[model samples]
Every structure is written in structure tokens, then in C-alpha cells.
Target: MGISVTHKKLKVELVGFRLSTPKHYKIDGVENIDIERYDHEIFSKYLSILLEQENVEIKKKIDNCSITLLDYSENEISSYAFGKLLVFKSGKRQRIVNEDDLTEGEFKNRDQGLKNEIHFVINKTTGVILVERDYEKIFKASLLNSFFYHNKNFIYDYVDEFNKLNYNKETKTSIEIHKNKLIYINPLPSQDLFDELEEFARIKRFKVTKKVEKKKNHGIDGCAKELEDILNKASNTSLGQNVVSIEYYMDERGKGLEMDSLKKMIQNIYQSHYYEDFIITGTNIDNDLKTLTKDNITKRFEFKIPVDIDGNYVDICILFDKLLFLIQEYIEEHFDLDDYYSDKVRNLIVNP
Candidate 1:
């Protein structure tokens, strides 16, 4: 028999973040520590606290998992760390049958272990942390928090231009087309007026007629005091019952919102008039959501590295070497590290 090995590529995503030091932290005369000052000792101390037994146990949907830093390296410009994540599942009883021998055996009561890996690099000069996208989720559970607490002298500010999508600050214009608009009766007519209308209708056998006496001008503004009593009665009551359908157009291309403030606004406008959808053609709604993409951003901060699939035993050292090589080549060829880092620093100062 011959043996065959298969290799698959796992795409690794790299993200960037800038460092900050909160203004209040300066009250005690403490300044943000430069990343270049983060030598082996400082990083080791932070990692030690992050890897504490209690800190490593993270809760997942189906099982409890532990993450441990397995290997690491550091240089003047960058620092790297790789870790293993193991998920522990309680064993369930299993039945094994031998068809040829007509015998059966039961196995139970053991723990099954599943594993994954996470790795990241910190660019000292840029204050950017590069990490794998999927692994980034695991770090969020506790490791990243603990790391930040232990290293409080510096704060991580997500300054990537694409990250603007997170704060809902992009400009956009919305065009709303209203249907079946209803006129609100001002002054709501008086009780005596209603009684007279009822009597007149009854005498006329409820036939539609223009001969009935009508109320005077009574503009909505002049009748505001009389309508105040009914405002509460009319609130949130399917305000848009007459709206057959709603269509929207954005100045910029984007996806339709299934459930959001817009839908709530529509309902309010239709039912209680709690909100109003104005038809302002040729105007921008500041901070309205605009989709973010590589095409829209000034520069891309993330890069992808494809790795070979090797089950739970992928070598961290080799992976680290590959990442370093790719990053170095990328910097040499296309990336302007200093320029990008300066831009992120400026953005952080402005937004912070």
C-alpha cells in the first residue's frame, strides 16, 4: 500500500489597529509607552497574566475551551505570538459492532479534544496588530481583554479607514415616496357638530351629499389645542395602515435594511405620526449609513495569507516564518508603512 498526503490552503486575514493613551491616564503624568519600548520582558509579563488558568478558559456555544500561548518571537520592529485553542467535549456512550463476529462492545466516559490555532504580530513602529480573522474571534473572548488590562499604558484604537463603517458616520441621501397620504381634520369638529352631522345623515338616510354645513378655515395650527387630547389615543396605532407599499433609493449603493429605525419610522409615520418622512430631493442626511468597501477606502489595511491545512498539528514556527516573509515582501513592494501609520495616528487623534 502507498501513502498519500493532501494539503489545502487556509486563508489568513491580517487586520491593523493603532495604539492610544486616554487623556485621563495622563493625569498621573503617565504617557503612552512607545511600542518600540515593548521588549521581551514587558510582553512576557502581559502574556503571563493573559495565560493564567482562569483567563484561558473561554465559554463557547457547545463546550468550554482553553487557549494557550505555545510559541513566540520578537524583533526590533515586530513581535509575534502563536497559540493553541483546545475545545473539550464530554464524551457520549458509543456502541461498536463487529458484523463478521456478531459481537458488540460499548465505550463511554472519556473526554474528546478538538483543537485550533491562533497567531498574531504587532508592528512596533506602526502600532498595528496583524491577526487572522477567524482567530480574532477567539481572542475577543478573554485573551485580548486581559492583555489590554495588563498593558494599560497603551490602548488599542481601531483606526483602519474601513472601520468607519462601524460608527455609522458615512454620508447618504434617502428618497422616500409616500402613498395614500391622509389629511388630518383640524379642531376635530365639536361634539355638537358631530351630533348635528349624525342627525342630518339620519334624516338624509346616510346618502352622500354636499349640502351639509361645513366647518370654517380652522387650519391645523389654529386647532392644535383641541387635538392635544387625542394625541395619546392615536400614538403607535398602526400609523401606516393606509400605506400600500414603501420604496427607497439611496444616493450610494447599499443593501436594504430589513429591520431598523427606518422601518420603525415608517410605521410611526403611518400610524401615530410620531415621525415624519420628508421628501427632500437633492439633500444629504449627515451620518446616514454608506457601505464600506476596498474601492471606497483610501487604503487597504488587511491582507490574506493562504496556509496549508494540516489538521490540529500545523507547525506554528513555520507559519510564523511564512507570515513574516509575506509581510516583509508586501512592505517592500506595495505598502508605505510610515505613511499609513502616520495617517492612522492622525485619525485616532481626531476621533478620540
Candidate 2:
């Protein structure tokens, strides 16, 4: 019988970092290497330092991790390096079946292992690093910062310029969001108080007195007193305006309600002009759609790349190598080189 293999689509997203060297930095005993210059020697030395037992710790808990370089290639514009970072916990005790007895389990406890791998790409010239968003649990911006900080001889440092990945009205990339995943909302007034006051001249003008209680004593014979009260109330009553600028968030569980329900609620808030911020607590995103605007985004949205997966034990290093060039191409097509060198981005770097 032939074994059946299933193929599936895996979504790929990468985060970018602006690479720079601190002015005071040095490699080994040599003087500071210029940020503009890079060669194989510098890359080799940097990788050696990270492979050290002491320098491998990405964090307090992940100290036993190991890193391996799988492939490297470069062009006139950029040099690409692909690698795998492996984290494992050893000495886990578990019982196994004894081959001698079919019905009986292991006589002695044995060590079982737990492992995780994060595949990444580094573009030397662009100073951008790419890793899938799914591995966010094991890989984080702070973790990378801490890892680089662990080694003094590591010549290059990275600055995450994710906000630069903003999209305009003309962008072709599609963005999808779950209304249920939205956990927070902040609404700011878009109309001025004077705009609300203009309503006085437009309405019956006497409806404003609807809130006034019945007088204790009859002071006027007609609606003139009511009209006076209306005028006073209309002048003193707080004016309400519509909210335009708004923000939304997702909870720890990454869950939320239906988009239809969210839209209705927003419409109500916009008209009432009362509510501001909200913390929605849920643990599910049942459905998703491309309904959010750029203003509602907190982080630059993840870029989706499609990958083919085989239903077998995967060689992640090989897989990442194949995808590295594709990711580099995506970066080249979407990001502007000038943005990385802009004064604003430079100030964001530690040594600039």
C-alpha cells in the first residue's frame, strides 16, 4: 500500500529590523567596524559568538538554546543568511514500553525531550531580520535585544522599525481582522463643541426644556416660561459631538465577537458621544474579514506568504532556505530603502 501525503498552506509573516553598529562597538580586539562595511569575516565572527555556551541564552529560561547557520547567498544589493535557533529542555523523565514484554511497560524511567525551532533570515545590507509571526511565543523583539546584549563582541545591533510598514489607499496587500479579537476601543471627538451648539438653531429649540421638572409655583401663564427655560437649558446643557479617531485591541486569549455586532456598537457610540475606551474580554475569533481601516491598526499588519507543507517530519532549516529568497524579494518590493536611512529612523537606533 502506498502512503498518502497531504499538502497544506502555511502562512509566512516576517518582522523587520534596521541594522546598525554602535560607534563605540568593536569586534574582538579590533577597532570599531564601520556600519557601511560587511564581509564574510564579520559574519563568521558574529555567528561564533552566538554559538558559545554562555552567549546562547536568549533569556533566563532559554539559556540552553543552540543556533545553526543553514545557508548563505548574496547579491550586489544585499547578503542573505538563513539559520535555525533551537530551544530544548532535557532530563525529562518518562516511562517507555519494554520490547521484551508486549503487554508490560518500561522497567526504568528514561529521559524524554521537548524542543522548539525558530527559522529566520538576516539581510546584511538592509539590516532587516525576518521570522514567522507564529513563533512569537519563542521569539520576541525583547528576546533578540537581550540576546545581542549578552555578547560584547557581537558587532551589529538591530532596531525594529515596524511602524514604517504603514499602508496607503493604493496598497495591494489585503488585511483581515476579527471583530471578536478586538479587545479595546478608544474614541476621540471629531466635531468641536460649537458644532454641537449649532443644533439649537436647527431644532424646535423648546425640546431642550424636556428635562426641566414641573415648576413648584406657577410663574408664567403660557409656554413663554417653558420657552425661557428651554433657552436657558439650551445654552447651559453640555453639547455632544461625534467621535472620529478610534483605537481597538485584542485580549491575551486573542478572541472576540462578531463584526456585525461591533459595527453596530461603534455606530451607537459615535452617535451618543459618551463612551471612550473599552476592554473586551474573550478567548475566540470565530470569523474574520477585511473590514478594518489603517487607523484601527496598532502594529503594521503581518505580510502573508504562502508555503507548501508535507505531512512528515520537517527539516525546518531546508524549508527556511527555500523561503528566504522569497522573503527578501518581498522586502525589496514593499519597503523603501530611503526610509531606513531617514533621520527619524536613525535617531531610533541606539548609536545614531
The TM-score measured for candidate 2 stands at: 0.36
Model 2 agreement with the true structure over 116-228: per-residue lDDT tens digits: 56566666555445654334244444345434444433333311111122212354321211111111111222232223222222111111111111342222221222133
Assess the local accuracy of residue 172 in candidate 1 as a C-alpha lDDT between 0 and 100: 29
- Tell me, by TM-score, which candidate is best: 2
Q: After superposition, how far is residue 102 of candidate 1 from its true place, in Å?
A: 19
Candidate 2 wrong stretches, greater than 4 Å: 1-4, 10-13, 24-44, 52-78, 88-113, 133-136, 153-318, 334-352
Tens-place lDDT digits, model 1, residues 148-258: 433332212222321332233233211111111111101101132222222221110010001111233322222222233223222221222221111334323333222
Q: Which ten residues in a row have the lowest lDDT in candidate 2?
A: 203-212
Which has the greatest lDDT?
A: 2
What lDDT does candidate 2 reach at residue 171? 45
